[model samples]
Target: MGSAAADALLPLDASRFAAESCAVVDFLEVYYRDIESYPVWPDAEPGHLRTLLPDMPPEDGESVDVILEDVRRHIIPGLTHWQSPNFFAYYPMNASTAGFAGQMLSTGLNVLPFMWAASPAATELEGVVVDWMARLVGLPECFLFSGGGGGVLHGSTCEAVVCTLAAARDRALSNLGHEAILRLVVYASDQSHYTFQKGARIVGIPPSNFRVIPTLAGSAYGLTADSVHEAVKADVADGLVPLYLCTTVGTTGLGAVDPVRDLGEVARQYGMWLHIDAAYAGSALICPEFKDYIDGAELADSVSMNPHKWFLTNMNCCCLWVVSPALLTSALSSNPEYLNNVGGEGAAEVVNYKDWQIALSHPFRAMKLWLVLRRYGVAGMRAYIRRHVDMAKWFETMLEADERFEVVVPRRFSLVTFRLRPRHEGRDDMEALNRKLLVAINGSGRAFMTHFVVDNKFVIRMVVGAAMTEMRHVQDAWELVQDKAKEVQATP
Candidate 1:
């Protein structure tokens, strides 16, 4: 190669790589150390980041030192520090040293294990880790590879839902004929994630066939078997086939848990697929006390949960297990001349995860979960979860002590939903007041929280599951909330 051509090529020298890697690690360490000093939510508005950089890609590669400086000055300010202990908005995106190390290893290797033979070790490791997770969470053997069922990792619960729904849809259509696709129906409570409806639409289930069963505040937002049964009965009477039923364990808004066992029975009556989305609450099931929440998971056709939510794993890792792998593979598997058929004759022995999800290309996400499990053993993880739950209880106790605020719903897991009590008589606009209070709190940048409206009432949701969150941080957040509440209340 010519000197200029060689110079233009990206550097792969071992020494330089190591130095740059170390520098990046140093920057990460400093960021972690000082994360609490920064705002949980950034003050930047839309299109603010475009002004920080040139419109075009860099003409030449720059040193890591220079790039790191740019990240500190320009990028960091715009980022919402999801890792900050003060961040209580949405669900926690937990990260740990071990998970980060696994991420680095995966990035460095950059191998795609779409098929078993594409990367044997990667595929085998994924099987091992997913099995380990299933066992740790006390899942039934029916959901394990050893028991004829298996699991695959997807980037998010939405992808998992889409894949499972496709499987269910195809299975029903196969029996009822393709013409029945228009008549196939899907069901979920109103509190269920919107992903189910999106999945239904993607899988060709008609919009009118999507049934949203309403739950009452009297039932604490839990989806009851009677509601699902009634919905299914109505659909069946209308000549629509019930193809799928989705239940939630720790719903997003109020942390409501659908009665899985009863709902499973209702689904079984009509031969409908039962899916349990335990995205945020599944990690808590590793603790024995929370096991009852998923007592009927064995009856589920497929179960999905996001390890990225609260399992101390980094961004984007969802584990999905199914009682029947053939259904998923039949619906999603695609083989072409360009792609090698690794599982030639005895395909049952091999697991090509590419067939079990929506995407053909996937990263080594199981590595991070494996690392998190190994680094923090089942006992350690249980303790971590317990600490967060205890802190949430502490926060709830504080809220109860104050007459100005009311707990909107019973505390479930580590999420506490509460709102200020109405101070005036004959007022129906407390929603506006609560909205203003939430705005003031978020605007202050002391701590960040998000709101949810349940049963015509607005409530602030405080999730205490960040890896670095401790009792002190929770206390500080409560104090900030109290101060903000007073300021908002004094306004009129």
Candidate 2:
């Protein structure tokens, strides 16, 4: 009776399972090939998706064909199509077919790579890919495992910053216990991403201890070493311990780059942990000319960069390298009975990634990164980056030529920040007009862009690195911006 019941519940045969999987693969292939690009924003409203999906689970399992049909009808139309070439908002979150295929293969394998013994190839591939990335970015040898330090791949730069801050906190507490280090201070520029402060808060650092250094208006929006030094000195004078300094190779708002070499010197004098958050601009270091932005990176105790941002990889891949692995491991390491294995006999013979960050069951993401690097060799990656940088400069030139628009920040990397010039009468209301123009431009849906508030004025940001973006797309985006500006200005 049990055997008969099992037979009734199961599919016809194993062949049926194989056929279903193949059908799904074929559907995905056709879907990806045919619907390559879609509008960034759908014409439908928020409730459109919910209305299409069933409110309750089906009484019986549906056929694969029915599920595929539902996916095509309901889900496909609702997606924002981030891979679309017309997407120029924020930083590039582009993915290549190669990377996607790698992800697919990883999913098929479905291995939990928490330890080296769990999946040897996965662990080793992570080590090798990170080393390759470190070399491409011209990181110091000290950050490589071979040179006493190592790297790990986290989900985002936020996690990287938090983990590094935790390590820095532990190191400081080792010298001055947690109770004594209550007055520990951290520093970052006002232009820095809010993630730095968020990280500080997660690690128990008080808001008062976080210093937002000031950036001069004419200084390309970079954090000056003098300001950082002065802030540290003031904190010390007030009997506060200066623990860490977070510098940005490229700020989120305007692609501002803090002076790394100078900041490195300041951090050294204060014995502070210097962690460079190069999440956006770090990929450009693969090109020889851009390496100068991180000249003093060697002095940094830790650094993080997101390959998923600029490289042709998908989202959720950030590489964090430390000058001392022991420091990071010590802060996050934990031991448990079931986790202990024969391979982990000696204290130095284990590598359990669960201790590194805030999660345990991480997807096998390193495979896609390895595939991206292998498929697109170092030269190929650099070429892609160079194209974006060149296009950004072209956009800057176009803005400069149009005497009506003013480039708000210095053009660094692939991000161009500009706004329409004040109405020639120098009216204080020009900022509001520019904000309206930005809204109109994005509302059109033909193109997508984002705006940032700089010095209390709204400026539209043009980020040009959508894997498939070409000179033609850049031209179209700029034309859209100009036309929208004209339309908005014509009103009243």
Candidate 3:
């Protein structure tokens, strides 16, 4: 520290902060209100922002107005507006008002509550909120903190998978010896998120030992227990040990839900740990009707879901619960002299969240989730989800009535997978035709959608779960698809 360098830092002036924050709030209000006017996907090329910015960092502190002006000029154009109601790409990562308010409050407080000693309220609030969520979603009692199991919020589903997989790996290795890691296997359906395989690799599970059981259209791409059993049987015959099975509640590509109860039975029979990844569809569990989808959740060793995706929580919030918190603490906990609490009086009662994940320091993520839950209550959240599901059903009905299009799979949650039927008889390239329609529709900037391939058939996925999306946006998107399909069909 030189005097000049220190002087460059912004002063801790409360009045200045208040004025700057008001400006930021105004900018964001306009940005969110007019989000639809922007393209769902940006037209900017790769490295576009780099070309527009200065090559070097500014040597001097900049005024708030100057920084915000640059953000409007250079940054806004390059962003793909995920908040836009017309945006129907991947599963929604909604940013509700309550979530944002909580996030802002957390940032203002800027607390890193890695352990109960660091910030007891933060740690305690996290545990309370996650348990509250468990009850709301009808999760098994074993996954609640009071029941001995526990939950922790992670940055994403991938981190949760990795942590749970690591715990399972450690437990298996303890009994089978470290060298037996090569013989231990992990299983997941092909329709499951790629995070399972990625998590396996990250946790040192041999690539060859990762088994991806193929899912069939006959079952709507749901992973069946029979398929998992057959895979495990083949692996066992080859002298391999089944260590873990990942069953999905709502898969990413097609919103397929594996039978958790049946799969858990198979996992238990083989002494394997069963983990459920319900990143998208878990929010629907708030309603009693969707509770049946996760009927076998009691058998799971661990489960995870993303509130950011559908529960009106902003990005970077994933809730993971395990039937045995000790498994995670034993696998991931690190003891360091500098980080220890002063006294051991409440050691047994306190939760050191740092022991629950890969990172030793994490944001006060529970604040946003607590706010979302409190602001909406369970009934409001359920109604919010139902609105999206209703819109999706309406879109599915519209597609079924039109002869030119075919609903690819049953509408699950808020996603509808559909495709334009083959125009000419004996045409074998329907995939290419459907892909062109998607490209054109997205290119028009009137609306946006993404696609998935089911049984080699290209299907367009219209996800209607964004916080601001309404029936009107869905109707407009359907008309756009129909108009684009007509153009695509008329062309060579």
Candidate 4:
């Protein structure tokens, strides 16, 4: 414990490891205990942390205690406390203590299960956990391991979209050959998450090959079956091949739910692959009441949802289900001499997930899903989903009571998008006013939320998913918004 030379800390022994880990654990306990008191967003501009810390890593190892001190001093201020009770921005990115423990366990094991022979337990656990997830959500057996298709955990929906698109592309190319790759087209609603566009680009699909079909705002910004049918018709008339159709269960900006059942029929009729992206609202489906929203998705070729977005799991974990595992593996699998293995090939029926996704080495993400599911049983999980939807409905009622604000979109799950309509005359600058109000609300540091432009109107999006968020916090946020809007309007 004395002030020894930096070299003394070079190699951490077991005692030193325990000391550092214990110190950090103590720090985390205090940090989460006081999370509500912290600012949701930092006042410091960019480069604040870089300016405060040393320009380079220490030439010699430093004591973990010293690093901890620097972290508390410099890192804490720069953090935007997404875990705060008032963080009603974007989707409900909720994380629980169990999720943290699961992540720590995964980090400890650090197994590379690229092949079943590499680690049988790791591969099997993922398959089992994914199957459990599918069953708990009432997904069809076609997407389960017992069926030919199955699910895998990805870092995000972007990765899932890209992987599934690759599979669909390869399937199309098998029949149409490489020249048709340019003619191959993917379709999504305008309100769809930008991830689909990003995925299409990553999969080498031409920009012109991707179609951005506009959704009707009057119908809650949902992509209609008629609109898609027409788009496909036009594409076919021009000799363009329709490759894939992406239907979203929950859109990002407005939380729109495209008509999946109707769209699926069109995709089926056209022989195009159907992929459903439920990154945000998928967690709601766990509750039986919300099962109706995804009724048509069972027939789709692929589907994905993110527990990290709303299901009390940590960040960066997405669960993807495909109706055809053979198609996915065939497109992605590369049998290099170095990776040759017979464990899963002959009699063993082991599934090496490396061939199912872009990455060969996947983290044990199933631990978080397993841990959270165990901590909150099926009943508890359903109750959690119901609480958020109920909270969202409550917020919507509050907005409706107020005459100045208009709910731009229908309440879907926990996301509520509303925009301000001026009660006073001669104030056509509503968009500018809402922007100013949003700036003031965020600047207050009492709470933090985000805004979006829907149907050419700026709207505030409030998502209630922080595990600690309560009714009182929601009420307080509205009061703050009303005050902020008044301040903006009163200004010259």
Candidate 5:
């Protein structure tokens, strides 16, 4: 009976298995080929995916046929399809065929790059790629290993901020006992990403010690040097030690850029470690026009940006560079006798990336980035970035042309923050009306957009960076917004 059962299972031979694999590939090919043309939002309701999946797992091992069937039936419909050209909502999480193929190859290899000895090639490749990126972005040589500083890839800007904060904290506490430092303060503009505050909290800085420097309206929404100086002076007067100042190149809510050169001077005056969070707009630095935003960035102790955000790479590729590796290593370095290896014998030597961030295990994510840079040369990347910037400018022009819509913030990078005017003069309910308009627009399912509340005013944000998005797509998106607003206004 056992022999018969084994024989029965073996009936589906290698040829049949190969045919099934081909079928899956063909299905994916067709799916992806038309993905760009798909609607940004599905017509289906929320519970659609949950209803299709089984409530519980199977007790026995299932055949490939069953697994594939569920994948086709349940999983495909639930996806939001970020790659679609119609996706003009949040900053585009772009991906390319080269990047996907590189990730696939890396997944197949499945190498653990925990230590230099574990995967030498993976480690070296990461180092080379980061250096290449730093050079491409016009980062100072001081931020590269060749100039005594080095970089490591983290999963997000949050992780980067936390790691840099930890390093700054450790450096501040080195002279005095950690307990002696009662009030360690950090400074950031009100426009800075909330992650900066989250990072400060995780690093043990009290809420009272987090200084939110106010940003003036119509003043570029960046953290001013004078505000930082005053905050640090007040903290010092209160016997608090100023430790970190996070300056953003492109704030999340609006693409507001902080004054790096001026902020660097203030940080130096206060003996604070300065970090530049350029998670969204840093990729544009590849284009020379945007490089000035980060001028005097050499003075920054550390800087971080997300390649996954706008560099045509897949998700979770944040590049962090530090002016001093010693600080980072001192903060997070660990050594155990069991884990000791011959490769770590020397003093000035190979790097163990585990000391860089909050995690021990990391995927071979560098492969995708390497593939992106190689496949799309620096010139190609610049061209792509310029195209989006130009589109954003065009959108700004259209918004300015409309008397009903007012651009709340100046166009910075590729994000345009604007909102509709009041329906009638002195109408106190304009914010509500605008909010309703945004809801109707997003709910239409033809296009997706998001809103940001700045200075207590509701403003819709039009972010244009979907990898395959063209001029026509932008035009269609604007048309949808206008039509949706009209529809909302026409309703009771």
Candidate 6:
């Protein structure tokens, strides 16, 4: 440890990093400002990007200017602009500058905070922010850390479903014996997201054990208690246990909300676990007015929402709350001695987030949560959500008033499902006709929408909540839709 040797410190040259970062920042600013000019969806067929780019990675490093230019020239054309105001297809993947800032900062830090001891500030702040969100959604105390329940942020609603379903699976198996796993059933409405069935597959639930109950337009496409009860009763009569019931607060295709209290009673009847998956519409619950959609959440063993989808957070953040953390921790915790914290079991209340999900490693997701909450405040979030819902209703009204069109299910949350009505009594090709109308509407380039089949009706879905969406965009979309519908009708 000679003074001379120690005095020779490492050189700190960061000019390249500074230049590249500045270039990226400038490009982002310009891209966001001029995004509306870009087509919301690409017209390119498959293999466009692959055919245009090099066959393999280059041996030499590319210049920053060259890379940035390539991004603008090649990457830009191939991408769908989800952030565009006129992009109303599927659901809004709303993101804000504040959330982007959090993402950038988190990536720079690049620390793995998978446990309290790994990065205490990140872990604790995650808990605090998640609790803040729980309150925002009007969740019961049982879903909070203070009431023996806690939250963890997963990358997607799919991951949340898988983790919670896995927890319920293990718990039910423990009590009923693992052999009975083949006979245990899971229940969800036909309109629910397809992720539940995917989860069932991942968790090894038998295909025969799933009950995808039919939902009708009369019930607004939601699963009813009676349907669930009859399914459970039939299974019980055959000596099968009803293991889990997933009631949605805003289903994917229809935005239909199941009767949570009624379904909860059905779950309770057979001692089954009730989990709520509100990936798309759960963010609306931040507004007190929308809280009725989740009236019986207290009876739920778990609940999840995608902040990335509607809460103005970017991709890769779904907050899942479990009433009893032990269920998941006990099922998924596989921390070896090497991965253990210094203080072991004595450190009781500390959360090792690694035990909560399938993956042991995760990004600093809480940063986005903290920043979004701080920047907008709950009031701003509520207004954002309400505005989208209002716009959806406006579009629904426009459809209902027109003689050529019909509102399919009334706007549920920020999604309006409607279609062009059949022109004649004997002509029942509305599905094919509406399909052409969708293509024309999207081809116009001013707006984009999606569709789904419910009760054999071809319903177009116009979902609001793009970052810059407003009344003008909604009205323009409606007008274009009406014009295109007429052209579609006149075609054949």
Residues 274-372, candidate 2: write the lDDT tens digits: 999999899999999999999988889999999899988887799999998888878887777777767744646445676677666656788989889
Report how far residue 54 has shifted in candidate 5, in Å.
1.6
Q: How does model 1 fare in lDDT?
A: 0.90
Model 5 segments more than 4 A misplaced:
1-25, 36-38, 42-48, 63-69
* Global lDDT scores for all candidate models: 0.90, 0.85, 0.91, 0.86, 0.84, 0.87
lDDT of 1 by residue, 179-274 (tens): 999999999999999989998999898888899999998888999999888888888898989999999999999899998999999889899999
Q: Residue 464 error for model 5, in Å?
A: 0.6
On a 0 to 100 scale, what is the lDDT of residue 156 in model 1?
93
CA displacement after TM-score superposition, residue 51 of candidate 5 (Å): 3.1
* Regions more than 4 Å wrong, model 2: 1-37, 347-350
lDDT, residue 75, candidate 5: 73
Q: Estimated TM-score per prediction?
A: 0.97, 0.93, 0.98, 0.96, 0.93, 0.96
The all-Cα superposition gives candidate 5 an RMSD in Å to the true structure of: 3.0
247: Cα error in model 5, Å: 0.6
- In model 3, which regions exceed 4 Å deviation? 1-5
Identify the superior model by lDDT, candidate 3 or candidate 5: 3
Q: Compose the digit string of candidate 4's lDDT tens values, residues 308-330.
A: 98888897789999999989999
Looking at candidate 3, the ten consecutive residues that score lowest on lDDT are 340-349
* Clash pairs (backbone) in predicted model 2: none
Candidate 3 at 467: error in angstroms?
0.4
Clashes (N, CA, C under 3 Å) per candidate: 0, 0, 0, 0, 0, 0
